[model samples]
Target: MSLPYTTWKIGEVEHKLRLTTRQAVAVEEKLGVNLLKVFMPRQDEDFPLPPLKVMLVVIHGALQKFEHGVTLDDVYDMHDDYVDAGGDQTSLLTDVIIPLFENSGFMPRQKETTDDQATLTTVK
Candidate 1:
């Protein structure tokens, strides 16, 4: 018999998205990867948490990386500026932001510019 497909869920719906184990692992190692960990946020979780918050955090990380190549780890090692960027900025970067960047086919590119317009090209 063919092996049944395994599935993953985001929010309520079962997503049809596909990722190889290597792809998933690359994304998982980054900040905010859920790995289906109990510590990770669930859509139906209690107050002061949700996936949207994580997405915002990661997007802000994108902005952070845009503004300055602030490795999310650096944010943890040092404080002051990143700490004050906002609660939204901090929690999400380590939870959801980096994962999205990887899972969304953005894993292998760096944002760049030419003619004063932004662009991304695959690194390999």
Candidate 2:
């Protein structure tokens, strides 16, 4: 499997997106938590979910790296439009980005099914 690409449309243009290592670091630093931990929580514990604002910022930061022509202001404007349209931003993170992280191996160990019992598979 590979990193999933999300389609981010700005006006009439659609950009295929994935977060880079640098972008991940920026998101982590800004949020003060491990992004993977939050997205891929262990079965034994729960990680704090990022607030809506932080989620938006992290995604915007990631987009800035992948989509060169997109500006921070543009991202915020798009976000506002999304909200105005009654779209939930949290879904944008969970439904879209989290799956991409899981496939891209950005997530840590997650539960796996074994014939005898459940096991953990570490994603590299």
Q: Which structure among the candidates has the greatest TM-score? A: 2
Tens digit per residue, CA lDDT, model 2, 1-124: 3335556554455656667778778778887888765655557757545566766766676676567667667777887776676657666676656655654458642465675553334432
* Candidate 2: stretches off by over 4 Å: 1-4, 9-13, 40-49, 108-124
In model 1, which residue pairs have backbone atoms overlapping below 3 Å?
32-94, 32-95, 32-96, 58-97
* Model 2 TM-score (2 dp): 0.60
Best by lDDT: 2
lDDT of 1: 0.40
The CA lDDT at 16 in model 1 is 24
Tens-digit per-residue lDDT, 32-56, candidate 1 = 4654442354577654233443333
Q: Give the worst 10-residue stretch by lDDT in candidate 1.
A: 1-10
TM-scores for the candidates: 0.25, 0.60
* lDDT score for residue 92 of model 2: 66
